[model samples]
Target: MDSPICLIENLNGTLSVNEQAIDYLMGLEQKIVVVAIVGLYRTGKSYLMNKLARSKTGFALGGTIQSKTKGIWMWRVDHPAKADRAIILLDTEGLGDVEKGDSKSDAWIFALSILLSSTLIYNSRGTIDNDAVEKLQPNRYVTELTELIKVKASSGASSADDEEGSGSQFVQFFPNFVWVVRDFTLQLELNGKDIDADQYLENSLKLKKGFGKNISDYNMTRDCIRNFFPTRKCFVFPFPATVEKMQLLDTLEDKQLSKKFSSTADTFCRFIYENSPVKTILGGKTLTGRMLGHLINTYVATINSGNVPCLENAILAMAELENQAALEDAFVMYKKEMEVVKALFPVDSSHLSENHLKSQTRSTHAFMERSLKDTDGKYSAILAGKIKEYANNLFEENQDASEKKCKALLDKLSATMDHGVKEGTYSTPGGYELYCDHHDTLMARYRAEPNKGVKAEEVLEQFLKEKSAESSSILQADIKLTENEKHIQAEKNKTSQMAQEKAALDERH
Candidate 1:
């Protein structure tokens, strides 16, 4: 097949139609799961949600914080162009205190609603005495849960089916809690003894005697919790939000910390994955709506384009002629590397748009052509002369600057492709140095075999190999396109029924 058309136009078509399809899929609400982030105000609840969604909306909520108050928020996430996943994030007001009248009852009500309907992601910074923690006390929140369980049990609603449907996990206590001691350290007493402070781990007994002094405490708090909820589970993760060493902790990488934080995160994910109703919510089967949304997006784009192969060929030719082969390669690599990037720093697909992708592709194409041409273009003589004059203008001692500029450009082109995409990094400056160490490498090769030297064909071969590797990156992207076709077929099958439903709903409205 005459070299299939490039992905650019195909992607464009896919994106355009995908937008409407997403609306329809989301409208179905066949499998919706709410995930809530609750904790003390300013304890990074919104921040975490924003991190998951990879948007600044949560950050905007932080900016709106003029003072401590209680307000619930919600966010809905759709699949990225490359993946088949959707998430709905929920934000509950800070639990312990509301700015006004009795919030205890209201707080408990909202808390229970979340507990019943969603997976709970309580803030790590909310500790034993943390206002949020206090609000979740057995007498308050858990007591309510206990009573609900008791009522359900008496009403014959506590059968195995009910237990499975309730979808709660048992408790697993996190070992160390960080106390934010911003720029200052205070003495912390443990078990009536002044514990010398640097970093220390207390045993479960110590924790019981110290923080868990009574049934009101967490460990024992589970006992009272168990009295009502023998089948339910709980967990505690202590986070210290100190100002003193905040910079050090925040800037530290996972590799630097021996995966302490990563381990904790894994445990949290495991709990969610294992829990019952939650398993159903996050399960692949349930996320089909979102997955289908992505499929529809691609399909619509495909139909609009009408001839995938022709479109791909045109785009590919333009990209290659423009020297953007590497750019195309980069996008493909991105599909494979999404999971890696997310682990290093969680991101949402919101920041990535069709316009952005196209822009990046075009820029990279231009950059590549410029890199090759400047090094050995038809205007080299005139360009060198102009550069010499420009360098002379900088200062009397800048005669070499012009020559250096040309060499630098060539050097950069040679170096492109040495490194994989950086974690938490979305884009890279395009050119040769980005590809590999061009100058030294080229010079070394030239010297090594002055007579039997490399040719344009060899260089092109290497470049093509890199591009091919990228093209092979993610099966998900390919599968997603196929899924799009499936969704289109499904829609066609149910078109009449859908039309009737829409007509009835419109009449009611």
Candidate 2:
């Protein structure tokens, strides 16, 4: 998109999906790496998203204390480091807006970001000190995720127990955690030893050795962050410019910004592009843009309906929609390919079978590519049945075509003999011998005809049986034929009939 669009809108404490944005996402065929940013109001989240989109201005960056971005805005761009992939950057509305006066709504927004993103960035300012960490607890963000999201649709554990144990399950489904501390001026040192950004984050998250209420509250947010998002990263950005110029940060060119900030921003973009994984669900089923679109609707609807969003339910819903689509796609491909062979009607049985097998293989591959969570092979079985039905229909049509063509050829070859029979030309003393000669010659011409298909021998056998009575009557009426000679001719006719029937049977088998 040229600019970001509102994917989900929060209006008066209620969230609704934007169909326009969902439609755009549905059109993308590539796998996506979703990165969502969330933090307190006025925290420079949109700026980072704009940079990741490779645009100086995309997501709105406000210069005021009021939250500018409401709900979630989305910008989709081609992935820089991965082939056939896209990067979807989500810039959520700033959390903790006083005017909003809705902490529950903010929590839901936070939960949605976690559910949708492959990399979730908790954008904060100043430092990763105790005060800053506490802001991520309670009415802030991370601590509310458990209340806002559920791992399973229905659990046997009580609500209190479920919440306690659900944090461990969040690690399996949560995004890679990234903490971006803007305007950070503290030195990266612990115990007088300089440390890297990751080590600094780990140090800040380290729990204290105590068990009182005060100590437990102090460790709560840190423990949640560590336990819920096992894979974590940190980036600390120096102040971009003076306070006066910071208001105009969005309009400033890269050269105009602080050199250190610019360099770190570039590195951050590179890291995100290279390291963020393709979005996936349970069973490691990769999600495409279409699947992601379905997910957005499912999660948002669940939230709007006053129910905690469940990852298992969402995946099940997505699987049903995707599996049905996959089945249709596979069946369509099979039909398209088989139609090409159908045009060449009356094909040899072996030729038709060979093409059917090839088409079936291609169709199954197509189905497998798009299908997910088909553990019971339900969709696969459906596709197989449809393909088998189509193959049977095609074979029937081929047989019918062969029968029509062979019968037409036989009729054309017997035209002269039919006219002679009607004229009574075989009533003379030696006419039976002449009749036999003509009949043999006609059979030879029919056998020499090419492309008669699988039904060639069967049709010819039927025609010969129909003419047997006529041939017998003609042989008995011949005045020139002696009893022994007549007997020999009858035996010869019987042998030829048996041979023709056997040939037809063998062809069919």
Report the lDDT tens digits of candidate 2 across residue range 1-509.
88899999999899999999999998888999999998988999999999899988989989988889999999998887787899999999888899899888888888899999999999999999999898885484776667777787775443535754548777777899999999999899989999988999999999999889999888888988888999999999999998899999988988899999999999999999989999999778888889999999999999888887888999999899999999998999999999998898899999999999999999999999899889899999999999999899999999999999999999998888788888988876677898999999999999998878889999999999998998888888775455657788889999999999999999999
- Candidate 1 root-mean-square deviation in Å: 37.3
* C-alpha TM-score for every candidate: 0.32, 0.88
Model 1 TM = 0.32
lDDT, residue 496, candidate 2: 96
* Cα-based lDDT at residue 489, candidate 1: 84
- The worst-scoring run of ten residues by lDDT in candidate 1 lies at 1-10
Candidate 2's displacement at residue 389, Å, is 2.2
Residue clash pairs of candidate 2: none
Q: What are the lDDT scores of the predictions, listed in order? A: 0.38, 0.89
lDDT minimum window of 10 residues, candidate 2? 155-164
Best by lDDT: 2
What are the per-residue Cα lDDT tens digits for candidate 1 across 310-332?
A: 21232223223333333334334
The C-alpha local distance difference test score for the whole of candidate 1 amounts to: 0.38
Winner by TM-score: 2
